[model samples]
Target: MRTAVTAMKIPPSLLSWRSDSWRSDGRTDSFSNEYFKRRNQLKRLLFACLVRWFMTAVLVMGTYLVLWRYSRKAAMISNKKKEFNTLIIALSIALGLNIASSLKHLDLANFEPLQRPKADYILQSENFSCLFQLGYVTRRHWVRVYVLFWVLVNVASQIAVASLGLTYNINSADTIAVTTPGVVAIPDMSNIQTGKVLSSNSQAISALRYTANNYGLVALAYGFGDIDEMPKAGSLFNSDGDLMYCDLNSCYYVFYEATPDNLDYYQSVATNRSISTQATCQSWRVLKGGDGTERTITIDNANKTQLTIPALNGGSQTTFMVDPDRGSGPTWGHVLAFEASATDPWFYNCNVTIGPVTNVQNPLQDVGVNVTSLAASAIALQGYGASTIGVSFNSTRHFQFQSYPAESYYGGPQGGNNTGMGQLMASFAVGVVAITAQVNTNVNATGLLPLKGIELDITSWTYVHIILILTVGLQLLLAVIAAVIASKVTIRDHSCVGLAAALQPLLWKLDNSGSSRTTCEKRIFERLGDGVKVSYIKGRSGLYYIKADE
Candidate 1:
């Protein structure tokens, strides 16, 4: 009937795809989007992990450097290179292990997003079955626990080692021996005369027999005043077998019995015109005595305050004569004597030429006895350089004189006296004695002496070794844990639909099959109906329709 034909129009979106291929194409696109999204998420997670690991590495490295510096300095101070090296090695291994464990993701190539999948997907997908596995979490927790334990143990070990190594006890003993000389002063002895007159010249004279006016006589001489004053000369002994010249100046004159040969030797040095012409005094060796010689006397004219007298019989006897009147004549009255035997030869002496004399009590009693009180002139012998005598003295006792060489007149031969110059003159009045003698002495004495030292009861090596072993064990555990976590975490191209939304599609498919859906599916479909859009193609028709829609 001649009707005009009209062209039918189709939607551009629907015209491009066949109804059967639409579902496949949509699924591929969705899967691709989900895969890219998951990949991007995993990349972000990996970046964060890398950043965290890098910071941890920096912190660990900084801590290690600080510890290394401290250990190096301590090693230098204590000279413990081995211990320092051991600690450094252990720390290095521990740091290495930590770094290695942190890099586990890179080693395993596991860049997984930690997103939770739908319960239905979990139940249906074999790949996502292990999402909630406790193995990974347990391993991570245990690794942390072990690392914490290791750190605590290491600290405790270090403290224990340090405490053990640093503390110690010391037992000590020391010996100190001292010897001092005695002093005797006889003042105001100018009028006393106990010997025969030897000279009438004003020049000072030596007391030796050879220096006396009588060249033919073989006898010791003693006196005060100038040679021109006819000073007396005397023998040391008298008719009653007692000391003949008991008068102060005469009795103290140092005497050495001389043979004819000794006399000739003295004359040779004394008569030298060059020596006699000098304005300043000079020293001359005048006498020596013994079987061959047991004593030697040297007279120093310039230094009249001291004499060099050596006891050839292995004795420490020194004597010095003092001039109290401050006259231009020879030294006359006071005598400072030092006596030390060879068997106990310990001597110390100090001479104080100027300054006020002060009292000195026992200061080193624990080390030795302070025998400074034995001297008659205690003040002069109290300070440094003063000899320490082993003998004790009282201020009330009369001065005791001990002679060497066994003089039959004074007493018998005395042996082994523990007295030095200071002790002998320790009791003297401070200012009364013009010249002071220095005495130095020591003996075989024993006492406790304090000394400083370090004892290593526990070594750093022990602690270092323990830490190293524990660190290695923990590091191994960390490696295993890292592997487990790396294996357990998984990434998959999951649909973007949520659990309830995904259930709607299953309900529709089940309903299309002419089967009643389960109660759980019905509830899921009802709850997610408004939130989901489902697409499908009409059978035997070219039109696409939404099976379910929000």
Candidate 2:
């Protein structure tokens, strides 16, 4: 013990009272000498130990703080989890709103043509698109969420509706009946004349004679059901007011042309032949049976069937129903009707009366008045009578009719655009699952991927949302608490605050060994029996040293 104590010699600078207690302030000070001489050994050792412990505490806290600060940034890089969440929300909103709006537009696309613009009409008529745009723009947010909810809700609703549909069956006249295979034809002929008090055979003969006379030119040449030429009026009559006649059950002679000279010759040559014509024309004479000359059919007049006035070919009219109370109107298209007569009757009477018929066209009045009024009146009307049971609706509803809600002309994705929310959600789920699965196989499993990831199935979306709400919200809450605790413990505790504020920089200046340099110095001087030679150089600030010859 005596030998160990003798071998330990303090450094020359530490031996001096000035160097032990005082620090250099640009130059050596006299106070340094006074302090060293006055201070005791135990006080110096205690101060040294306090400084070492303070520096050690500061370094530990600083490293922990650095790591904590970088953790959020690292999470941003290794896991795009938050980004996917935001993306899913935005995409869901965009898709849901557009889809719902599209359906709403479809419901009313053809109800009022003016409400939906023509393909090029949006640019041409701002008035037309204005109504459509107004409907959707204000409704965008609710519509999007509504659409998504609808998609989910509709799955259940459709199943219920399907079960309901099974309760009743509805079909149109297009259904086939086993009793009838084809159209049944009826025959009538009051057009042929020249008869009174005649027997069945005589009446039949008269009918045969009349038909042969009228249609004989063609029948005599080509037999019954045959035309020698497209028929002409005078083809069957001879100059003598006689006919090229045929009896029932015989083929007849051909008479393409005839004059007075050939009448007898024709009669003799046609002795073995007789032909009959099928005349289908019927006639009805409506004598003025009613009290007044001005007569009306009164066809369900209270129900208001639109009777198109009689006109020559290619003519029409336009009209509208205006609600006096509501200040609104529904414009309409033309109507049509036909009349018939008998003389010169085969096809000429009704044909001449109503000129050539053609198809009618209109945007609003595609369906006739009867159907249009039923659909239109079903909605709320301003002037509906008190007696009316179901004029306008109290709430909006979806109704289907043939000519009413035709295909919509607005708010649809053009040309195969995959802009729906369903697709976006599906894509995010797929991407997340893929990355997470890859990382679970490849990287350390402790990463963020293990904590926040999802599968590609939409059926599981609700559960995923629930999990996210619980997980993220909980994490945010915990992080807030943890940050508060960490800050108080790190920055507010008296010793920790002092260590950080006071001793951190001093330890930072200790070169490679840092604050451990004192241990290294003690081992060299006290245990190794080494002495260091100090060299004084003018204007130098710190001690310079070399190992003394051992």
Candidate 3:
């Protein structure tokens, strides 16, 4: 039982039939022949190639012409007098056009419309109006031009601003250190419960007072530095209404007035308030967050104690000394710290209780007895520079720390207080260093060989490259368009016989036995080609042409 096997090659026609079968059903183009007009296709392809080449040539020539023309015009105008006149006239015309456009779009004001709209909570919500204000700016040519000019002006202005910053002599910032007592031990303050009012009026006063009493507050005197020269000792004074001279301390004249510290000032501020639960007055707690890097100290009016020290002079740097308590091992305490402007020193609100405590053992000695604590003996006080001021005081009441308040209460002339001069010099020095660092140059260090590279090179490089690319691209594009227009003029569509000859292959024939009859009838009705009409009427086959002799 053997099976016979046969192999046969398919004919071309058979293969064509098989290909047709393999064609995707319902997917073949329905009107593929519509684009197969050979004569029309030839004309279009020729036109496209002509247009492309013409455009390329026109672009090249136009760019060269524009640059050359502008350069020649600039060179010919030698006298500043003529140049100025031309420039002014051109600027005036441009300005007038800009003004007219602005006026045409001006929105007139009406009293009713001018009335402020009620605050729309929906619109005010960040979600509804995120970046919506950007839409108000109109995008117009004049506006763009104005913005460009403004940017250029600012670029030039920065030089002057930088120079001013360099010239401004900054004195060291002023910082005050209020003396405090060292905490030997925590005196079993666990018996004192939270929310209990230590004041007689049942009003829960700030526990900071008791804490400061047990554990002294160590306040850092910032912005304090060496002065050019010390002022007369006649400027220094004590709280006892007596002028005291310290041979060890240097004094300096200050421009602002001072206020003597007294107990009456404290009592006047912390008055009794209505009794409330600790929960209700929970706002009194100075909530500290993070590693004290960013802490918030919030106190309500009822729980707040206001003690007005001498008002600081407005816009002036003050100097003060950082004096430590003798025999008080590493005095540590909590104090309200204040930060000055970039040019000023970090100041402290001297805790009235923490400074020169009275009505106690060793009263009026200004001992470091005010703030002692149990957790840590050595506390940090703020010093000059942008460093953190960390200090643990005598009181076990630990509070985290962070940036200073948004505003300062200082209100006198700089250097008015005797202690302000040194502080001013120190603060100024720190501020200068900060400014120098911000400018990316270290003070007293030879900046990099190219100082500008550190400050502005990157931005300058970016803009330079951008300008180069844009200018080159724009020139090329403009030249292209110009060349295209110019080429359309220069490259006349002179009928090229060669192009016409090349199209001969796409010709078609209309002469046939039946078509000849039709052609004769059409030529007769069209009143064309009398010869062709006659030829068609005579039943002769030939090309149809119209002539007078026909």
Candidate 4:
């Protein structure tokens, strides 16, 4: 038992406190070493924390400021007011959450290779499992790509909503009015024919010859012409004579008197040369009797009556005759005659007389009035005196007519009570109140126009929005994980083993004994078995070294 105790006892040289010569070795106090290591770790942790805070502040506040300034600048340049407050708030929240999560993932200890597995080892381990392969590479790039895609989709949706314009229906009334003027009168012809005389007798003789030949009395008058003869007097005859003649149809007696005054008086009223001589003879008051013939007579009195004689040439003659009962009647009676031929019969004479002249004023009148339209089912016009006019506006054409509203004259669609008088009265009332003389109306008119309203079709984008939201969340998560991975120090293969395994060789005396070595190896194998394949291989130095298989 004494021998076993001695073998297990620690040597004095190994323990510095138990050795008098410990000062000769250049080693610090164990407690002080531990204190310094702890202090260094604390400093490192604080530095890491400060860096994270700085990065978070820059990312959050800097991004917000940049985005705010950019939005304002864009609004000014485009001349449009855009609201980004909500978007800014949402972005800030997202960034804050990201920062918080990133900070949460940060571990100061992960920065030390002695404290954790290196990046290569982690990557190797991740290769062994498909689940961890994503974490092997940074996911920040993919998250940024996805965020861009989401932003594009959101912008497209907004544009689509803006493109949907306006729509609606309209209805109304329109009116029009028109006016025009009335009839005209005629002028006189007697004063124009009153100044010529010697030429009158010649005209009378020529007229006598024409009348005698026209009546077929020339042959008979010349054949029996020798009752009495007198001295030469006028151009009507070579000498004064009285001639009597008879024809199968009638008998005529001719006498000529060619005084200048008498010729002048005859010329004033004669229509032609044939009547001039006969007119002069009658005015002398020498001949009297019915003569059973018709002749034109002229009277100068203002109270004279007018008469019309039918002519052989399909025309009539107008002449004035004095009122026989008037006190200022002419002293002479004029008679001129002509018998109708058997081939042309004459009926009772037609008497035409001039009536007293009247004075008149023109009233408003509408002629060729037209109303047209496609929208109106009916159009109507009404005027004073209960006159109404209507048009069936069914045809896209003009409705035209002459209408006298003041005279109670109406045209167009008739019979309906609302159409004629009633409509006219309504129009008149409107005009009176409106201080206008014309009124127009439309019936059953319908109009159309545009209105403001909108509807969004988001059914197809429902899943897309959801996907975008989830993608944003995923991006944040990926960013945090990437931050953590970046902050971590690269780990070595040896660091994967726990402290117990590392201190095993130091705490136990395994190198001198086969059993102890076997025990240490077995312990190592047991602890690392789940993560890696452990094997022993002989090296060139003729010693066995442990190896980890991937």
Which predicted model would earn the best TM-score? 1
Model number with the top lDDT: 1
Pairs of residues clashing in candidate 4: 117-491, 118-490, 118-491, 118-492, 119-491, 170-447, 207-274, 382-424
TM-score of each model, in listed order: 0.25, 0.13, 0.17, 0.18
Candidate 4: tens digits of C-alpha lDDT, residues 337-404: 12122222211111111111112111111110111010000112111111112433322122211122
Candidate 1, residue 333: Cα displacement in angstroms equals 21
Report the CA-based lDDT of candidate 2 relative to the real structure: 0.24
Question: Which tens-of-lDDT digit does each residue in 75-142 have in candidate 2?
Answer: 22223434444444443344334323322221111111121112112212123244344434433464
**Candidate 2 regions with alpha-carbon error over 4 angstroms:** 1-39, 74-550
lDDT of 1 by residue, 1-550 (tens): 5476683444433112222122324444231111122334345444445554554455445544544454332112123435544664565555555544343323222121111222222233222223233223323464345434434544453443344223222111111111112111111111211133334322222211111212111111221222232212211112122111112111111111111221222100000000000011112222222121233332223442333332233443432222222211121113333333333222223231211112212221111111111112222121211121332542212232223332321112223222323222211221112111101121111221112111222235465445445444443444444434433322221233322333444455556555544567556455444345443323232322224444
How are the candidates ranked when ordered by TM-score, highest leading? 1, 4, 3, 2
Stretches of candidate 1 above 4 Å error?
1-46, 54-296, 299-550
Candidate 3 has what TM-score?
A: 0.17
Clashes of each: 54, 6, 69, 8
Better of 2 and 4 by lDDT: 4
